[model samples]
Target: MLHLGKPLVVAIDGPSGSGKSSVSREVARRLGLAYLDTGAMYRALTWHCVSHRIALDDAVAVEAASRALDLELSLSPDQEYVRVAGQDVTDDIREPAISSAVSAVATTLGARTQLVRRQQETIVRAGRRIVVEGRDITTVVAPAAEVRLLLTASEEARMARRGIQLGGSQSQEQLAVQVLHRDAKDSTVVEFQRAADGVLTVDSSHMDFEQTVMAVVHAVLDAVGGHRKNG
Candidate 1:
């Protein structure tokens, strides 16, 4: 449904475990657009700080590290990965330790500034035709995107999905900290729990991944019609 001549930029925001990452990636793949995971950028910074033994609570040090962090991220949804300083931390970033500490880095104001600037640069690199998802993408990062969406799910649904991803090994309490607690922490810096004006909201609480993907794709087509108009 995309107009090849005028590439579309889709900005999606959602809480953790709402399926935004998986859904946005699939939508980008279907539309042949680049994908950006802003949350992973924060996670990469967290991984870097942790590797260097930088305390998460040290705001000044974390902000300095954010500016100097060397990160390489893949835009292909099919081959998504993150590398920091030539070291592959793709799998390491998803470990429970990183998940538990990522919000600390994400909540840092100066850190967010650095990452957001890089995100804007990335969007430009994509020719403004990309599917970017994260806490503040629809509002703060790309408020003027061609298509803006906020994906959400009930707490029960979100926890269930994340629990399955964790092989049901994490206790309900552990999952709560990872999902609810993390969202609460990140929400302070970015208002992603609700849809902003001009942003479409998709509740994936009941729908499967394919259904959610279609919902987002429909949002994009609805925004600019099936074709770009002649200037």
Candidate 2:
């Protein structure tokens, strides 16, 4: 087992379909750390707004909704659930409707601010030993984390993986919109496609799930080793 003496915050940023969520969850499970899917937070907020008939374009209303959102999400990798105001919306947030509209909420500066603050609080609540994965987790949410990584993949690979994830229901065009177009819109707000300073990049274009997980695990260990040497 890999354990850092102090709190460990592993922040991972990645584009859509890069497997950040699954890989981060598995990494946390293996390391016995808390797991946080920050993207799901955004998705939950999006679902909340949509369910209430709030206009996505109305930034003010959206921000207000974000502030008032009563969200409960699973912190354990062994369990997965997301609730909004005590209502289970774990699977609803993953719906295509929420995916298509989440960027609007994510790009809203005010809403993002609120959610980022909530995420930071969650980190502190988790004893600061957690694996957090999202679009701007490394840059914005946990910039001072012990381990920061940007997981990326080729567009072709990402599209294929997303298609598989959606169970082949979405057409190629739909996948393009969800994977490529969504990334393009979200990029306007955060630079997740590239790695920031001191952030390692893992191109999982050719690696399988296990390979990618091992690569991230190795990166964590390497970072720990470097920290020991510097200390």
Give the count of colliding residue pairs in each prediction. 0, 0
RMSD (Å) of each candidate, 1 decimal: 3.3, 3.1
In terms of lDDT, which candidate is strongest? 2
Task: Quote the lDDT for 59 in model 2.
Answer: 95
Assess every candidate by TM-score.
Answer: 0.96, 0.96
What does candidate 2's lDDT look like per residue over 80-133, in tens digits?
999999999999999998988999999999999999999999999999999999
Q: Can you write out model 1's per-residue Cα lDDT over 1-231, one digit (the tens) per residue?
A: 566758578999999899989899999998888999998999999999999999999999999999999999999888978999988988999999999999999999999999999999999998988999998998889988999999999999999999999998899999999999999999888899898888888998999988888888777877878643232
Q: State candidate 1's TM-score.
A: 0.96
TM-score of decoy 2: 0.96
Q: List where candidate 1 sits over 4 angstroms from the true fold.
A: 227-231
Off by over 4 Å in 2: 226-231
